[model samples]
Target: MTDTALDMSVETGAASYGAASVKDYVALLKPRVMSLVVFSGLAGLIVAPGHLHPVLAAVAILCIAIGAGAAGAINMWYDRDIDAIMARTQKRPLPQGRMDPDEALAFGVFLSVASVVLMGLAVNWVAAALLGLANAFYVFVYTMWLKRRTPQNIVIGGAAGAFPPMIGWAAVTGDVSLASIILFALIFFWTPPHFWALAIFRKVDYSAAGVPMLPVVAGEAETKRQMLWYTLALFPIGVAPYFVGVGGPVYLAGSIILGGLFVLSAIRVLRSEDHKPAKQMFTYSILYLFLMFALLIGERLAA
Candidate 1:
């Protein structure tokens, strides 16, 4: 669909929204995405070099999840137009006419402010600031600017998702350090290949939505090539925590195995003719990140 058509549909949809249930409001938060964000942030907190009161640690994590969810709500509101046209997003609250766009925006802004303020008060200002920055970047830089305009959207915007670990780390240490930055880089590098795998399989959805995802703009071959490059880079970055002394032997061994599987997944995507491998790669990418962070958390806690 064209931009004009999408806008028109969005306006029409916005005019007739029904009552939103608690479930719809929760859906607006993008819980699946929030889970991963919280998990990664928890890993960062666990692996960091200091101690936080259990209460403060929980508050920090809650803030991270809320900030991420706020960003997601804003993203959905802004992208409601294209979302209505896209198959994957068609059932979203806004596109489905289940919630008001203005309300969604307000809810997001409220949560954003609340999360940052709470984090600053309960945890540390550094983590709060990073949370605020991540939310702003996701909403303003990624959703509003880069997504429709550039194929590099995921590459640059991935930094927003990468912040949780850093935020968690900062929450414990009260500052950003090399270890936190390495955690940030791990997610930053892992994002493109992970997202591009989905894009490869959902090219038609992105194309119809007028989004310039890598596969939609550059074709599957180029997208797969880019995915391979990112995965190769990710391999070393994923295991770097070991050398940096953040992870132990178990983490080292597990990271190597996980990184190898991620590379192999990307290679399969590159060589496959059908969408199955890309879909599998997308699924595996989620597992790869989860396991990588799990190793970090588990190893640290055991120590």
Candidate 2:
């Protein structure tokens, strides 16, 4: 090859190497968190009073999953600096320079808009509106406004995560109801204890990153105190679907047992000095939410 041709070949190779892999784009979605969002959205669709066509239901879930991914990518784009400082998030695609910030931001915005539009076309506009609102809240409210400003950031921002069930319910019924609101309440209350557990262990990271997570802004003792309170509040709200007769006895039983365990875990965190309870709480909280929703799904299927 001539010198100019060799130079062109070298530049092309470098560009190819610098391009983001598919896996990197997927990682920008925060797929593990997306899994939970998808599952919860599915549970909402299943337990709602009306029926949706299976194909449309799948679309609804897909939109929710994509919307979640979009919001997460936006969050990653905005938080790249702090993300790089935090040990737990330091390996993410943006922090590692696998993708440009603008690329991630555009990817997130595209997914966010596409997901809402798809939901509106395939399902109902109600669901689409809720999805749009959730994405907006996560991006504009939580990520931009509240995240760096307050210790109560996640507390208020938790509502953004709590909207999936309502969206799912709206997918089927085209309207919200008391049951859907109760489902929303379940997640809203659970968010504090669940995330505070993680914040307890990740306090150093939050501190170093200059993010005022509860454990970073308040003392651990106060954070533990709040976790226990939220867990207590969650107990009644979580089991409400059963008392409302939407779920059968099986659900009621599971809710009581799981809720008791969650409260106990919070109590342990409060009483102990080690991070073990907080760590355990963080791990089990995921299981707790999953099984709690599973009970509602199981009862609906069985009925």
Candidate 3:
């Protein structure tokens, strides 16, 4: 699991790869995470004041999804060494010796450029720029610079994930606005507690990979405390649109309920040492973001 061991295995993996399939390439994209990004981006597009043609709207979402996938592929390529050491990631194509890292990197770069260029041609340049920035930030800033260097990596690196909704908003409006920025803030503040909850239970995985996640670098107690703090901050950001007259009573009420449950889960994580609470917190956090975004989109449709 050490760096030297990882290097040795990676060299072996590079020499002998199997006949990898299309599915393995898709797996490199981190499709589940990209789904969330697409959904949130769509929600932003739906809530924005202007309208986009149905075809263009679909294209916008497609570009966003592809950009996210490109970033994820690059991340996987860069992290393959440590990924082989982690239990959850050991089965990944690169780590499993089923795909070459160079191939993954090339695919990632190809998709990254194509997505941005297509977005610019079919949609607006603003959206394309945001997508490019998000890809760059995730690949260069978060993956290469922060992941191995700092415990607060997710805090700052989270800005990369936060760009999707803004990109969606910009696609329709051709400009960013307070509403879209609020959407961005909501996700930015939500990232820390969400990832930290996983880190709490996956401390051993991070330690083995030598990644400096909060729990691995800061200890469980500090990480738990920070989770509570970030969750508290996230609740207000989640509900901010309601106060700003962007979201309605339904969105307001739903966010309140969801945020309350999120905080309660965070409290459980804070108060308990059992892995059960952290696992529960991680599950609820995903539901929390999904439901909150759903409420906003539903409110927009109802209006």
User: How many residue pairs clash (N, CA or C atoms closer than 3 angstroms) in each of the candidate models, in the order given?
Assistant: 0, 0, 0
Candidate 3: residue 70 Cα off by (Å): 0.6
lDDT tens readout by residue for model 1, 1-303: 798986887677643565688998999999999999999999999999889999999999999999999999999999999999999999998998889899999999999999999999999999999999999999999998899899999999999999999999999999999989999999999999999999988899999888999998889999999999999999999889999899999999999999999999889889999999999999999999999999999888888
The 10-residue segment of model 3 with minimum total lDDT is 10-19
Q: Candidates' TM-scores?
A: 0.95, 0.95, 0.94
Question: Model 3 off-target regions past 4 Å?
Answer: 1-18
Q: Write the per-residue lDDT of candidate 3 for residues 1-303, one digit (tens) a residue.
A: 798986886677643565578999999999999999999999888988888999999999999999999999999999999999999999999988788778999999999999999999999999999999999999999999999999989999999999988999999999999989999999999999999999999999999999999998879999999999999998889889998777899998898889999888888888997889999999888988899888988889888
RMSD of 2: 2.5
Model 1: worst 10 consecutive residues (lDDT sum): 10-19
What's the lDDT for candidate 3? 0.92
lDDT (Cα atoms) of all candidates against the true structure: 0.94, 0.92, 0.92
TM-score of 3: 0.94
lDDT of 2 by residue, 197-252 (tens): 99999999999999999999888999999999999999999889987766789999
RMSD to native, candidate 3:
5.0
Tell me, by lDDT, which candidate is best: 1
